[model samples]
Target: MTTCRLCGSSNLASVVDLGATPPCERFLTSEQLDEEEPSFPLHLRVCTSCWLAQIPPLITPEETFTEYAYFSSYSRSWVDHAKSFVDAAVDRLALGRDSFVVEVASNDGYLLKHVVQQGIRCLGIEPSRNVGEAARAEGVPTSTTFLSESSGSEVRDGHGPADLVVANNVYAHIPDIVGFTKGLRALVADDGWVSIEVQHLLTLINNVQYDTIYHEHFQYYTVESARNALDSGGLSLVDVELLDTHGGSIRLWARPREVTGEQSARMVDVLEKEKAAGLHELSGYADFSANVTRVRLDLLRFLVAMEEAGKSVVGYGAPGKGNTLLNHCGIRTDLLPYTVDRNPYKHGRFTPGTRIPVLPPERIAADRPDYVLVLPWNLKAEIMTQLSYVAEWGGKLVFPIPRLEIVEVNS
Candidate 1:
């Protein structure tokens, strides 16, 4: 029986059963590709008690993250997004050399590096040893340890309380949700603020973004559930902004519940929208499974048609979401010859379950595929621009999620 992680309630409503899927980032070597791969049920559950939507962390964090495959700095668009966030955050907070910034799960210091460039004091708490070490080498003060109430207090004792804490796309991956968020509470100063960005659950359902559901992600949060999770850690919402990244995301600004602050209009506005969409009830999940099934069938038809048309198809990025899509749709190198990625770590490896060979981005031109299926559709604009030369040979770009469609862009 599945139970809600936060409230300890047994009333879990099944949202979508995604069969069994391997952990998304487990890119294999050629030799290991022949080895048997283990997979777990990709079932998602929503708590009728607290209305928190989550999937169990079927694999251990040590198994999933120690020597990680994903490095955040590889995506130029994502890096620029981080830099822009830094500029706005520094100015909005009136931060300077006097303020301290702590970023949890600061992958390769992608965001904190910008914080350091501005001469602000910054610390990165990264669990992935390789990624954390890389962050330190890049001159972002990084600690290679998981954040918890005890460890967070130790960090505060050594470096003093943080003035601003940033956590983007990290909370969902956590298994011990309450403990970790409580740690975030302990890490910040009384007057300090915490900013968290997570993909909105409402958007996931509407867009049929089941591909975003993988073993690494333990929970898919809505505004209501997110607020409750933060409140459990003694935090209260101060502001929120809806972002278009990762399909769709919500940026929440929170402060300690003890520190009085008025809720921003945007935060309240989003909360109402979430409520109107029935996010607080189990009915919000009714159509989710049906939508996901329709998407799977639609994607298969598109790929099959393109192959029969004598067109060569290759994938653009080997993101975790890409693995989910490929594995669920059961596409292999037969349907898609190969895929390319900018990160050198993934260059010689094969994607997890599908075992598609991954190559360097430069290989695309030589292979000269007719249709470049962008696996990481969230960053399609940046990728399409970088590979605009594909249009020179009459190649087209295709997006696999939201719908299977060919997107027209500048060559």
Candidate 2:
């Protein structure tokens, strides 16, 4: 972390230090709980030279994604979002049955399945074998490997240039920003489009979404920084769209540098918004660290008060972000005994440093806890609807980030 990953600059300023925590997704089995766990410095810094906010690459992608625990299809809303993106991309790119589409980090074929249904040629480059197998089971032609400059070229050679390359929610996972970007360039055709969806730094700061900061996400991006990163790999940013996913995100439309045209109006508007927010400079990040502290304090206070009031509290989701929040706030099983998730992969495992048991979603109804702390608050609407039956026992839902609020559920 001595030099910026994007730009080789010694000048890096602290954005926030989440303290030392294990890789967010490293859920432990009962046997591993007795063993000592390893943690790393989870500090985030911003490069003054290029304005890219990043964390040290303490853990490699191989360590995290090889046996991934997260499956995108588990979240109904996310699957729907992926389907919408596929429909929109096909129409926008004028794709047809003859067109070829490729998606990077295509977990469980949640997206490419839509492309397959339309009789288009599609492939998924997923690193995780288990999830990749799941994708194959669903009829997605998947290549199990990490995406890099060389790998990207190989894919292009084997499958021919993709008409469209889709990377969703994975732009930040790679430590080698330049190489991954080049890999993206290699997978796409000279005239084909590359669409990437990543969490927007502007919204992250504005909304106090600090939990999204974890080891897997090597860097965070503003549209300005993203444009620079894209140019490094010979890809040109053509347009941008604001998305409400992952707290807040931006969908970047890019193309090979040779065929790139005038930047779209939406791209210009977003850059203007970034400049107005002072994101192009260091001022925009000045208040973020302090805001993060306030969130920690507020959440801790609520959990402690709930304990004192004899109200039983449990977690709703055991997502990676939830682990970050749980560890940063020093929450343990004493406060949150267990959390539930829809994914069966995590049913019997425990959350990485917190050691809270992960149970099935039905456990919530069986126990009828007084309060359910909803993690993965980005899916607030979907989760609220799923847990509407909580009202049967006058149970309430609690959200930790941005602020602590308790909402009574009504069936």
Candidate 3:
């Protein structure tokens, strides 16, 4: 039985099934890929008890990100986001020179560079060796190992309890969600805080973002479900914020159970909303499969029409969601000429299953395709702004999910 990762409920309903897919980061060389790359089941199910959306068991952190291909320094907007986050956190927590901040899955020290610039002592725990090296290059101290109970113990011995621990878009990535949170308990100092930003389940359902379903993201979180997980790990949520980043996300602030303060009204507000929306009810997941079916049809129809029109469609950002959407919709090189990524690690490789070639963003500009499909719909605004020059040649940008629409940008 595929039990709920959070509540251990055995009742799980299969929602969206994206059949065997390669890990999103495993972009393969043309020669190696032609020899037949492996793919795994990409099925997602919502636990009836906790409403935690997750994929069927497959892959591990070591399998997904250890020799990771992604580097945060590639994205200009992301670097800005990281810098702003450091500023916001330092002020919000009244952190000073004496304070120490630790970031889990702190890819390439994107955020901590700014923390260090502010003269705040910071440490990054990154599992991916390549990205960890990049963080080290940026002068941000990093530990290149998975953050778990054992790793947390080692971290505590060296850095003591951390004043602030930041986990951005990482809560959903681990298979052992409980053990991961328990590690937080062992590492955080008294009066310390943990802030985790996860793609919201509410947004997933409403937007029909079934493409976000993949093995790397082992669990989808709702405010209520996350609170339950934290409670089990001996922590309390002191605040919660709705962030516009990552399509839609919830930033949760937590501290140890014994620590008490007036809980942020935002936290109570989100909890009440989740309850009212039936996130805590068993029946909430029943209709999600139907919604996913509709999304698949809508996307396939759009792609077929674009192909028939002889319009060259290219994809932007080789994100996990793009992989699911492409594999689920049966899109191949016939429909997509190639996809571009800003990350050099993804260059010179083909996307798994579909075998669409991954190229640098300049390829899109140089080719001047009629339509550039925005794959990472969450960052459509950021991408559109970056590629605004596409409009100079009268090219239009298209978004496939949640209905297809074309918007023009002034160069």
Cα error, residue 269 of model 2, in Å, equals 0.8
lDDT by residue for model 2 over 51-144, one digit each (tens)? 8999999899999999999999999999999999999998898999889999999999999999999999999999999999999999999999
Which of candidates 1 and 2 is the stronger one according to lDDT?
A: 2
Counted clashes in each candidate structure = 0, 0, 0
TM-score of 3: 0.96
Worst 10 residues of 1 by lDDT: 402-411
lDDT values, one for every candidate = 0.89, 0.94, 0.84
The TM-scores, one per candidate, come to 0.98, 0.99, 0.96
lDDT of 2: 0.94
The lDDT, on a scale of 0 to 1, for candidate 1 is 0.89
Best by TM-score: 2
The true-versus-predicted C-alpha distance at residue 374 of model 1, in Å, is 0.6
Off by over 4 Å in 1: none
Please give, for residues 233-297, the per-residue lDDT of candidate 3 as tens digits: 88888889998777788999999898957788888898888777766774555677788788778
